[model samples]
Each structure stands twice: as structure tokens, then as C-alpha cells.
Target: RVFDVLVEGQLAIPALDLALEAGTYTAVSRQYTVKVSDGQLNVRFATRQGATLVNGVRVSERPDKALP
Candidate 1:
């Protein structure tokens, strides 16, 4: 089973080095919003269930991949 945790209102993903024990793989989509104001930046992630508000971090000016 996939476990999702929210820290300080932000969703935190487990480190990639961890191995999954057993479960059928499923596709999941995550959406994020980045906002900037007064030189301060904020990010939020949204999923089908609900939304998570992130703080103290900003999206990179140049994303390695662009979204359509």
C-alpha cells in the first residue's frame, strides 16, 4: 500500500531508497501550485482527495521539465 503523509500541511514523500514490500502498482497524479509574493514563495499540492499547503519553500526558477 502507498502511504502518504502530510507534514506541516505539506505532503511528504518517502525517500526513494526505501523498498516497497508488496502491492499492486497504481498510477497517481499530483498537482502543485507555486506562488510568489514580497520575495516570499509558497507551494501547495493538490490531489483528488484534497489539497496540502506547503510553506518555506519555493519552486526553482527553471524547472528541469516544463508542464503543458
Candidate 2:
């Protein structure tokens, strides 16, 4: 939260709600879009960043193998 207020909050982005969460991250500089497919079975994040994390742990710089 502090990072968004102090650092991210200062960003000149519009309609951007920066939040720390999980999943495949790909917003380079917090710019991207999200899409839901597979009948809520999968989520697609189309962003500029390529960092993906799970359980708050960075698993890879891009989308990792889906865990079953």
C-alpha cells in the first residue's frame, strides 16, 4: 500500500489502481488490461510487465506453467 501511495501513486497514470496481488503480472510500469476466459477457469493479463508471481513469490519473469 505504501509503495502505491508514495511511489506508484506519484505515477502519472490515468484510471490506474495499483495493487499488490498474485497471478501472472505483465504490466510494464503498470499499464495493461485483463480478460477472463474459459468460463472463469483462466485469467489473461495483457500488460507491459512480464513478472509473474504466485503466493507472493516471484515464480518467473513471464507466464509460468499452469499448476494443476
Best-fitting candidate, scored by lDDT: 1
Give the per-residue lDDT of model 1 (tens digit) for 14-59: 3211124422343333445433334654333334333432223434
How far off is residue 42 in model 1, in Å? Answer: 18
lDDT of 2 by residue, 1-68 (tens): 11211122233333223443422344424332223233332222323343422233222322653432
Each candidate: what lDDT? 0.39, 0.30
Deviation in Å, model 2, residue 10 alpha carbon:
28
lDDT, residue 58, candidate 1: 30
Q: lDDT, candidate 2, residue 24? A: 35
Per-residue lDDT, model 2, residue 68, is: 27
Looking at model 1, the pairs that clash are: none
